[model samples]
Target: MVTSIILINAERTKINEVAEKLQEIAGISEVYSVSGKYDLVAIIRVKTNDDLADLVTNKMLAIDGIAKTETMLAFQAYSRHDLEAMFAVGM
Candidate 1:
């Protein structure tokens, strides 16, 4: 599985509407309205790299209110819980 976080800059008046539309897309797992240089932040999970590309290029970019996007791909995770589990007493 491939996961990506997309930061979306949308038209000010259209933020909520755009966020709602993004939530309906297949690869988008989460969407939130945020305050900063960007208006919304979304989490997307797809089957492969091509799927991620399609979502960003074809789907997300096609949305009406979206102006621009910055995508970040997660390469590895090192959460505290994961580290503890990995070192647990088990063979």
Candidate 2:
């Protein structure tokens, strides 16, 4: 599976709304409200790059109040917990 970490910059007042919207997207596995340079983080897991692209471009970007996003494609799973989690994606 392809995994991506999408860091989001949302309009301050609309962060919660943006995060709620992100959680409704199909390929996204998790959405987190975080503190730092980025206000939210979305974890996307899909079977192919095309699926990842569709989720990011079509669904995620269309959400209101998402000011900006930076998507990072993960290359390898280093942590044991993450490796185990990868097997559970499609189940």
Candidate 3:
């Protein structure tokens, strides 16, 4: 799967609504309303890079209150629990 993190900036009044709308979109796995330089974060998982592009450009960007987006493609995933399990396997 192709995974990406999209940092979203929306109209202040519409941040929650934007997040709700994003969660409804296909291929958007998760949406978070956060406090930071960006208003929200969206996690996108798709079958292909082209699918990612289509979801972001055609679906997400077309939303009414979304102003800007910065997309970061994920290269790898690491978690402490997974790491611990791996080490325990050697025991």
Model 1 quality (TM-score): 0.83
**Candidate 3 residue runs with Cα over 4 Å from true position:** 80-91
TM-score of each: 0.83, 0.87, 0.85
Best by TM-score: 2
Across 1-91, the per-residue lDDT of candidate 2 in tens digits comes to 9999999999999999999998988888899999899999999999999999999888876898999999999998787888677688953
**At residue 90, what lDDT does model 2 achieve?**
57
Model 1, 13-83: lDDT tens per residue? 99999999999999898999888899999988899999999999898878999988999998876668547
After superposing candidate 1, which stretches have Cα over 4 Å from the reference?
A: 79-91
Residues 1-91 of candidate 3 have per-residue lDDT tens digits of: 8989999999999998898899999999889888889999999989999999899889987899999999999998786854897789994
**How many clashes (backbone N, Cα, C below 3 Å) per candidate?**
0, 0, 0
Error of 3 at 21 (Å): 0.5
Please list the residue runs of candidate 2 whose C-alpha ends up more than 4 Å from where it truly belongs after superposition.
83-91
Give the 10-residue window scoring lowest on summed lDDT in candidate 3.
Answer: 77-86
TM-score for predicted model 2 compared with the true structure: 0.87
Q: Judged by TM-score relative to the true structure, which candidate is superior, 1 or 3?
A: 3
